[model samples]
Structure formats: structure tokens, C-alpha cells
Target: MSAALALRQAIHDRLAADAPLAALAGAVRIHDVPPADVAFPFVILGEAVVADWSTATEGGTEQSLTLHAFSRAGGRREAFALAAAIQEALHDAPLALAGHRLANLRATTAEVRREGDGRTYHALVRFRAVTEPL
Candidate 1:
């Protein structure tokens, strides 16, 4: 598999297997493509961008991953809490990527805001990672 795909799979598996995260977001609430009738206060594996980070002797890749947390609570607290949990789960995590080595993973940024609908709160958490072929 491509480095980006491997990284994404590893991340999803890690998040899905985290007990603390599941407690906060509920079981199976983390999704690549959320169902049409999905509930609020869930997480979505959002966009990903990949670029070459190759050297003369080795092949590598840099990836930017974005995960979204949605909540319809009375305030932003729920969304922010979910974002924090996600960051804690992934920041510097020792994820084993398929056919690649995870060089580093860090939570880069997190933005929480109320959506235009005015009732939904959205938290966008971004992560930066580097991977080298094994």
C-alpha cells in the first residue's frame, strides 16, 4: 500500500481501538464515511494530502490528515473535548504502518467553531506525519 494509505489505516485503527476515545465519542462513531442517519457528537476521518519526501537513497512521504468532530451540544465543550482526546491519542503515537515506518506523528492544529446552522459545533483537528518505506 502507499504510505499515505497505510498511515491513514493505522490512524483509523488506533482511534477505533482507543477505549477513552470510544467513551467520549461512542462505539463505531468514528467513520471514514459516516452513514446518512448518523448521530451527532461523532468523528469523521476527513481529508488527507500527501507529498513526496524522498531522498536520493530512500523513499519517504509527508502527509497532512484532518479529522472532524461534530457535536450538537448546548456549547462547544463537547466538540473541544473530542478534539483533545483525538490529539492525545495520536500525538507522537507509535503506529505501525503497513509496509512503511512511521517516522513521526503530531497534532498540528485544532480549530473549534459553531457551524453556520448555529446549533452544530465543529472541531477540525489536523495532524502531520512522515513515513519511510520499510
Candidate 2:
């Protein structure tokens, strides 16, 4: 698998399997997009951008992985809590890439805000990943 895809898969799998995340978001509703009528607390894999980093004898890539968390709690609390767990789970945590080696992975930034609708809270967390062919 390509490094970019592998990185994303790693993040998704880590979040889906985390005990903390599961405890927070019971039933572990992580997906590409939550159903319009589905539960409030859930996570989604959002935008991603990957750049080529190829050398004469090696192939590599740099990627920006974005994830979104949504909650209906009174404030941006639940969302922020989940973001913390995600960062702890992924930042510098060794991940097995399908066909690449992760050189480094780290949390770049995370932010939470209340939507204009004023009921839903959204948290966006982004990570940077560097990988090389295995």
C-alpha cells in the first residue's frame, strides 16, 4: 500500500481500537460520514493531503491527516476530550504500515468550536506523517 493510504488506515484503526475512545464513544461509531439521524458522538475521517518524497533508491511521502469529531454535549467538551485521546493514541505511537515504514508521526494541531447551529460541537485534529518504502 502507498504510504499515504497506510498512514490513514493506521490512524483509523488506532482510533477504532482504542479502549478510551470506545469507552467515550460507545459502540465506536467511526466512519466516513455519520448518518444524518445517527447518534451525536462520533468520529469521521476528513480531508487528507499527501505529497511525494521520492529519492533515487527509495519512495516516500508526507501526509496531512485530518479527523473530525462531533458531539451534541452542551459545550465543546466531549469533542475536546476525544481529541486528546486521539492525540495520545497516535502521537509517536508506533504503527504498522502495510507496505511502508513510518519515519515519524505527530499531532500538528487540534481545535474545537461550536457550530453556527449552536447545538453541535466539532473538533478537528490534524497530524503530519512521514513514511518511506519498507
What local distance difference test score does each model get? 0.91, 0.86
Runs in model 2 lying further than 4 Å from the true structure: none
Candidate 1 per-residue lDDT over residues 91-118, each given as its tens digit: 9999999999999999999999999999
lDDT of 1 at 59: 91
* Backbone clash count, each prediction separately: 0, 0
Query: Model 2: clashing residue pairs?
Result: none
Which residues of candidate 1, in runs, are more than 4 Å off? none
- How many clashing residue pairs, candidate 2? 0
Candidate 1, residue 104: Cα displacement in angstroms equals 0.3
Please provide TM-scores, in order, for all candidate models, with all chains considered together: 0.95, 0.92
Error of 1 at 52 (Å): 0.3
lDDT of 1: 0.91
